[model samples]
Target: MRQEKLKYLAKLALLVLMGIFGSFLISEAGLRLMNISYPVFHGFDPVRGRILEPGMEGWFRYEGNAYVKINSAGFRDVEHPLQKPKGTYRILLLGDSYTEARQVSLENTFGRKVEQQLQSCERLLPHLVEVINFGVPGYGNAEELITLRSRGWAYDPDLVLTMFFSGNDLIDNFPRAELREPAYIPRPYFHLDQGELKLAYNFQEWSPPILKYRLLLWGVHNFRTLELLNQANRVLAARHIGDSQENLSSRAGLADFVYAPPQTPIHREAWDITEGILKLMHQEVLKHGANFFLVTATSPDQIDQEERILLKERLATKKLDYPEQRLRALGEIEGFPVLNLLYDFQQYAEQHPAHLHGFSNTKLGAGHWNEQGHELAAQLISKRICQDPSIL
Candidate 1:
């Protein structure tokens, strides 16, 4: 009777193992068949910081299950040829999330919209307006400059638009543990050493875990099921640590230290770093004979009357035109035309307040440029470029 029971148990165990294997095969196949690759990865660069894992195509479910296919070149946009075609007017756009524009469809992105608007121009129609988006999320001045240096210069653009998001860029320009730890992405930090830019936290390589946990990183990034589990684990960890949903996931913006003044020593330090980077960027653009334009992109809080009041109250300020003045000053100093969009956004918001409904956030009610907002920005940009006597 004992021998018979042992044989039966062995048979049951074998059946269970087979069932598990079969389920794994099915799940793996389903995910692949659906083009739902797991773990859309971000590669840590020693120089600029985290880059979109190149050549990865998958659905990033975070922003309304948004489908993102990171081009082989590692940009968020479609693949662009390196060689400039004759008569092609290329515009290299550099910025952060507002410029990366994951919040909307590619067609709805401001850069593409700018392209569409330029296409409508009779004079510009003879030339192709190819706006290369080098906008990476969580990027600040240093990273943008690095991106332009590494690859943007090769594009042979006629113009370079460095869109500045005043909200969080000040803080993003420098490294702070409070801002970066939660995000868990390695970033290259910079400082003006003897009035020259120097790398501080040079590469993610310094973080031993990035190498030690290499397999874990790959598995988490490449496997969708693992990524989902990782996301769930992160949420749980955030809850356990008593962190807010935004605190854990939010990129640096809004509650900005650089703009919120008592003008602490650190804040002032950030300003210097930012200015130095801009100077370098401008000089580089000039070297290539491309006109550089600085567009100060506004956050919703800066435009919405109600939101503006609340933000100022939090910052304990009356009104913050600090960013605009600073940007315009840099434009004067660096010799790049600064297109301050503060007035444009305000006037548009006042005229069509209903458009705020379109600026609705897909995740956590975090408002960004909706379709209408993109249209406004694009039209403004196109108009400005058209009016510029030299470039068009």
Candidate 2:
């Protein structure tokens, strides 16, 4: 009877082991054969830190399903020359994903839309207009400045448009702010030491992890199982590490206030620091002899009265003022006109109740702007550009 029991136990163990190995083999084969790549692909850069690998063709899974193509210059748009075409008025549009706009096709992005819409103004501006999109995903103001100074001037832009999303940019610009990103990538930030901009944070040394985490970071970025585990770990960690009164001064505490909105006292310093960064960016744009325009990319929560109500209901707060107003003030003082999109976006929402300007989160119509939103942005900005002789 004892021998029979031992044999049965051995059989059960063998079956379980086989199942695990079989699943592993299947997953590996699927990854290899199916080209099931990570949503975004990137290569480490010595200067830019991490840039989308040039000539990369991959799938982008957020906002909506679409394939992504990177130009040889490591930009999201098609190839544009380093030298501006003769008699062409070139515009360099800089921002995060909204300007990168892989969520829509090449023709549908706001950058492309602006390019197309400019044709109507041939009589007004005379010269053909070309807009080069240098938008990258997950970029903060600091990154934008770096790109502008390093690569933007090469295009010899007549006008440079920087889109500022008031959602998390304030925190992103703060080096001490905690970022609970899945990959825990390092971002470069500037520190004002005695009124001088000092570089802080080394990219390679930012998150020196053990061998297991190094491998896990690769898996989390490329594979699904690891991503699930990372997200689960984040939830658990958040419960324990969520901001407390004692850690209020800590970076994690500052980032946790993303739910609290910018009007909260904890974020006052972040906004002030961000204003300085904008002023620095303005100076850089002027050095390149390009007109700088700041576009306040209003978050989904701040666009319409209905969206504002949703935030108030969820957070139970009467105050949800974002950093756009402050950014506008800084822009005014810094000599750049901030394109306030709130009034126009709200008006569009009222006029077209069925069509949406943006999505709520990562939902198809939730987090980022929808097709209609991009069109609206292009229409408004293009009209202004055509009429404003001062910009170019």
Candidate 3:
């Protein structure tokens, strides 16, 4: 009877080992087949010590982080950590993907434009201006504010400009839903407790294994899964809009392209969330003794209203939903001095019709700014800053 029991125990142990090996093989195969790349998720490298060198206008992996590169005219990475420069009025700009310049080169980014404009103005004004871009992709206002308070305050910025993109910034800030994949780490939100704002995540005190698991899951699922899902959704949405194979191929041409706005009010949560985010951002900016300037980034539809309406009707005929004026109204509130780039770009497009080229050159591609768009935005922002010296 003892011999029989020993044999049975050995058989159970063998089966368990086999199961573990099988799972490993399956997971390895999936990783190999996926051909996943770096910057898989945010916080994979929470400390911003690593720097990616300049490269061509395509995706590149650097230090295990994936980044899209652009060859903008005069863009360079600030290699050293941000420190307060004496005798200079520094300006820190923060926002999400749009501010991050996803599709545009660094030189063509609004941050660069603002910097150039400020440098030019320095000739006339005695005080010199230095603008730093603290923009990160997939970040919400909460992240921006947190970054400003934690990382950015050390730079001693006189003014903090937060560009608010109305579409997804709100959804990006929602509580659990805000927890993005590893490539895009969501900034922690702080609640006021006992008259003091505490750190949201206790990184120092957390267990290493738990943090690693969280980071790994974020890297694998958030960065990889969601990206694939978004591409699939866009394709499906395009099909629902009855786009032809040729039209789909020319999606790049429609860089300013937008699908039919969703009819459900559920999508409108972006508005409320953005407002709340702005309020939080304002408080954070004030805490740092820096003024906050809110810039309203324009949507493609806002630039071409009639064309967007026609597209909306076309999608509606196909029984597809889309966002409408309710989304636009989110920007019209009278709290801060808002720079409406949508109207400015529309007017510019009217004057320079040739500016509306394919996806690579258009201003309407997912809130990214082309060179001309950045130039215009910089000019407008400069004018506003000059007009309101108090904000400075």
Q: 248, model 1: CA deviation in Å? A: 10
Model 1 worst lDDT run, 10 consecutive residues? 356-365
Q: What global local distance difference test value does model 1 have?
A: 0.74
Q: How do the residues 1-392 of candidate 2 rate in per-residue lDDT, one tens digit apiece?
A: 99999999999999999998888767767665766555435544545555665777677664566678999998889999999999898889989887887877778888999999987795445788899999987788888888887888889998899988776676667756343342346567776778677766545543454233445555765665454455567557757653542353343345424435554544666666778888888888888788888887756776556667877776676655445566667777777877877668766777766444444445432467777888888998888777776665
Winner on TM-score (1 vs 3): 1
TM-scores across all candidates? 0.83, 0.78, 0.60
Clashing pairs in model 2, backbone N/Cα/C closer than 3 A:
359-365, 359-366, 359-367, 360-366, 361-366, 361-367
Cα lDDT over the full model 2? 0.71
Q: Which stretches of candidate 2 lie over 4 Å from their true place?
A: 1-37, 122-124, 179-183, 205-266, 310-322, 355-365
Q: Comparing 2 and 3 by TM-score, which wins?
A: 2
Candidate 1 similarity to native, TM-score: 0.83
Model 1 CA deviation exceeding 4 Å by range: 1-41, 122-125, 177-179, 182-184, 202-207, 212-214, 234-254, 260-262, 355-365, 390-392
Model 3: lowest-lDDT 10 consecutive positions: 47-56
Model 3 residue runs over 4 Å out of place are 1-76, 122-124, 176-270, 304-307, 311-335, 355-358, 361-367
Which number leads on lDDT?
Answer: 1
Q: How many backbone clashes does every candidate have?
A: 3, 6, 19
What is the Cα-based TM-score of model 2?
0.78
